[model samples]
Target: MNGPNDWFQQNQDRYRREQYERQQAYLRQPQRPTGPPVRQRRAGRRGPSPLVVFVFSAVGLLVGEAVNWFKDVGPVFSSVCTVVAGLIPLLLDYWKSVAEEPAPGRGRAGAPSYDRGGTAAGRVLGVLVFIVVAGAAAYGISWGVGYVTGNETVRAERLVSPVAGRADSMTITVEGVGVTDHYTKVRISAVSRAPTAVDVGVGHDCQLVDDGGQTLQPSTVANDQTLLVPANGVTVRAVITFTGRPAPTATTLTLDFSWFLAHDFGFGAHSLQVHEIKLKADPA
Candidate 1:
């Protein structure tokens, strides 16, 4: 029943009240964002870079080689140091990569879960690389040492023939002495008339006599033909007989000794020889 002016005034008042109530409500309530909170990319822990690791490894190798060049130390030691130094940083990088990677089942929906960290396969490969590098370095060092040392030598002597007889039995003798960086086995031989021929019997109507002057058996003759000598100074002897009717013309006997050095250090072998001669004639 109000006039136009009155109705207008009432409408204005209602509108103002509603606006005031809305303002009051807004002031009383906590401020809230209209949308979801923005997620920020997290910064990862800073670590040494792969490039840095590689550079350090190279430096280590160079340092190791330098040490070997300047010092008389064995190649093995220097190479080991190089390998260990080079591998440490690599191993650390591998471990760090593994630590920074997200574990399984941690990715968002529909997103592929990546094990950014090293896998078991990668770790195994790294270890194998380290071992290979180490082994190669060690071998290089050993070779260097051997090259520098050169081949070693030892001296030895042996008496080739100590006994001589014609239709007579006599004992031959051998002797020797020497030094070596390794163990060696020695053999000595005695021959009649010719240093190259082993003779156990005579046929010219002459016969070797034992103390009883009896002809010696071929086995007995050959049995006394060889001797084994040791590395150090040693004296060895063998007895043999000659048989011939013409009193077995005077005969010459010869002895020869030889040896070979044996060792495990990759050093080459060494050897020596010695000889002796004697004459035998019919026993007056």
Candidate 2:
């Protein structure tokens, strides 16, 4: 009963209405964001906190300074201080082991609680101990190597001995010369030709002079100080120590006994004298 044209117009009206309805429904719905997707940061293992590191470093520095201050006291004292410092953290860790009690109807009472703070502190202390031990071991090895090397070098070179020189009525004979990287030791015997006992003092007046004119003072004296030389030729042995190895060019050593003679022996400046000894591979 309907014509073809009418049928086509009805189909077109239905299609338009459906499209309008779909657009309206879409418009009523919430709008979706069109920006880039957000990303979440992944969790990872963390290192020691700044405060913990800072505290550990501060403690280490304090301990190091304390050890250095004890060096002048003696090596034994310094070593003891270092050992005690290393043990302090371990002792504190032991004390930090605290027992916690649970509530009356809860889990086992008097059980030990996990202390995160204490664990962290223990780890830091362990790291500090390792560093200290490694440093000490390295220092000892270096010292040993230096000592061995110094001895080898010293033994290869020849030095003059039995060299004698006189100042005023006192005569000094060089008995030995021992050289090393850490120190240089000279042994000498002194005797006086004076009719009476002569008082002689060894101090700054004693020095070692190199061929380059560089002079080094005695760091220590063994069995050597102010001495009384008997009237006869009775010899007194004195060992003089100078810190560190002397220059290879040290072919001569000059000793000034003027001050000691003037102060102790009542010798005038005009009567005072300086003694020079030649150091060589062969006797002169």
Candidate 2 off by > 4 Å? 1-158, 220-225, 260-276, 280-284
Task: Give the top-scoring candidate (lDDT).
Answer: 2
lDDT for 220 in candidate 1 is 30
Candidate 1 yields a Cα-based lDDT of: 0.41
Q: Model 1: which ten-residue window has the lowest total lDDT?
A: 177-186
Tell me, what's the RMSD of every candidate? 20.8, 14.9
Residue-level error in angstroms, candidate 1, position 226: 54
Q: Kindly list the per-residue Cα lDDT of model 1 for residues 37-127, writing each as its tens digit.
A: 4333335533356577556655666665566544534455555666676677766865776675566556454443334444569767866
The number of clashing residue pairs in each candidate reads 15, 0
TM-scores of all candidate predictions against the true structure = 0.28, 0.40
- In candidate 1, position 186 carries an lDDT of 21
Q: How many steric overlaps does candidate 2 have?
A: 0
The Cα local distance difference test for each model comes to: 0.41, 0.54
